[model samples]
Target: MMTIKNSPASQPMLSMTGFAATESRFTGGLLLIELRAVNHRYLELNVKIDDNLRQFEAQVRELLQSRLGRGKVECRINLKSDAAVANLTLNPEMVGQIAQTLAALQQHFPQAQPVNLVEVLKLPGVCQTESIDTEAMAQSLLNGLSQAIDELIAARQREGEKLKQVLLDRLQGVREQISIVKPLLPALISQYQDKLTTKLREAMQAEDDRVRQEIVLYAQRIDVDEELARLNAHIVEMDRILTAGGTMGKKLDFLMQEMNREANTLGSKSVAIETTQVSMQLKVLIEQMREQIQNIE
Candidate 1:
């Protein structure tokens, strides 16, 4: 039996998509277990098993829930008699004896039915099938199921590593966009002040205290420094969460929402073409991360 265990600190981001299969043979039967998983907001398990294996469904469900955090998981278990295990062999001697007896009976009663091969096979000892060991079959089923789960988790982890790298790349893209927006802020303020001064001088023909106050207020309104700062903070937290990965799907998603909110605010306060483009690019990157996060567990 294979035991699947991982320390929380060592656990990586796990994708909810995976597949695995395992089988074990007993006295006269073969037990097969298969697992499939796909993304879901919560753990959703559906188990299907042979009628004889119904008794073990609860145990299988418990085992899956204990190891998996989130996914729509489907488990299928089947038990079937293996011909090799049954060891079906013809008893040549028995067949010869039965044939002789049937021939003799037919001669004595001419009207008697001709030798019926089916009836001969039905006679005692003419055909035999190995008896199944119920207990052994049960144990093999549980052990095979354990091994299958281990394989499924391994597949999920491999996929998760890929998702993690994608998310990290998108986060870097978001940082790049933010950096672009920061340098443009000072230039944007200067440009806005110049434009406002031109309009005021054209109407009043003089610069005054009123003009300075209006410029300050307009700069404050368009300042996205605070939103950018918060976005950077969210990115830092997201990096930390990814580094310490363990069921961080929901947390990463929430952080994405926060980042998007900041991006929206930045766009709303945009006073220049460069700032508007930065805001849109930031939102695109954050949306990409959020889409990938949905598949993480």
Candidate 2:
């Protein structure tokens, strides 16, 4: 009944996998459907049922296959019985022909043969008609399954929502780190220029203004401002998709890769210790999001 995201803080979350069990004792027997789902590259469903309900396999499969879009889902449907719904009728003509044949056999082998009444009954024509409300039973089972599937899909969506929220939070974390590293850029360049200028002046006895200007410009190019800008843009795009709320798994995953690319570039080009730390954090957060997005539909 509780079709909420199985996000237990003590546990590692319900995963992209979950189960919803529903039982509805309908018609003359009981109808039960168990729906289990796991993360899969595509939507796949396996259904299991007793031989009595085998005739309705297609109906059950279609119900689930249409409702669920992704994941390897397994559904087990049970149609059990407690009492017989109808009586069986015998084929009178077939039974009479079989009886005549047996009588002729008895005439040929009088002392050696005797037919058991149960054996005669088992000649296949003795028992004839089976009557049951199959339509009512099928409808009952389907109704129960429909309810269970509704709960199952709602569970998947609720979990997807939580995943979206977590990814967005990590994204915002990356943005905050980017913010922290932004104001440090100019100061970082100034620090590098001052150090390299002093080193150049002492190490090579180079006091030419042009040489110093070249060193300053070279150090500025190593700054990660451009990488930060691109990363921020990627973050904005990812946030847009998360808000739009559809099947954006692959898109989000690609964005994660792009974010990590920018973070890596940022780390490699980064000069300030603060920038490097922030860049590393961005990479970590993106990796986390990537792992989670694999489970999304």
- Which candidate number would show the highest TM-score if scored against the true structure? 1
Taken over the whole model, the C-alpha lDDT of each candidate is 0.88, 0.78
Cα lDDT tens digits, model 2, 217-281, are 86677767678779878988987777666667778778888888888888888766887788789
| Model 1: how far residue 243 lies from native, Å | 0.4
List ranges where model 2 is wrong by over 4 Å. Answer: 1-16, 84-130
lDDT of 1: 0.88
Candidate 1 lDDT over 1-297, as tens digits, reads: 999897566567799999999988787878888999999999999999999789888888988899888999999998888777787767788999987887788888989767767777877788766667778887888889889989999999999999999999999998899889888878877887788889889988766777789889988999888998999899899989989988899999899999999999999998788888888998889888899999999
Cα-based TM-score, every candidate = 0.82, 0.77
What's model 2's TM-score?
Answer: 0.77
Clashing pairs in 2: 89-128, 89-129
- Those runs of model 1 whose alpha carbons end farther than 4 Å from true positions after fitting are 1-9, 84-131
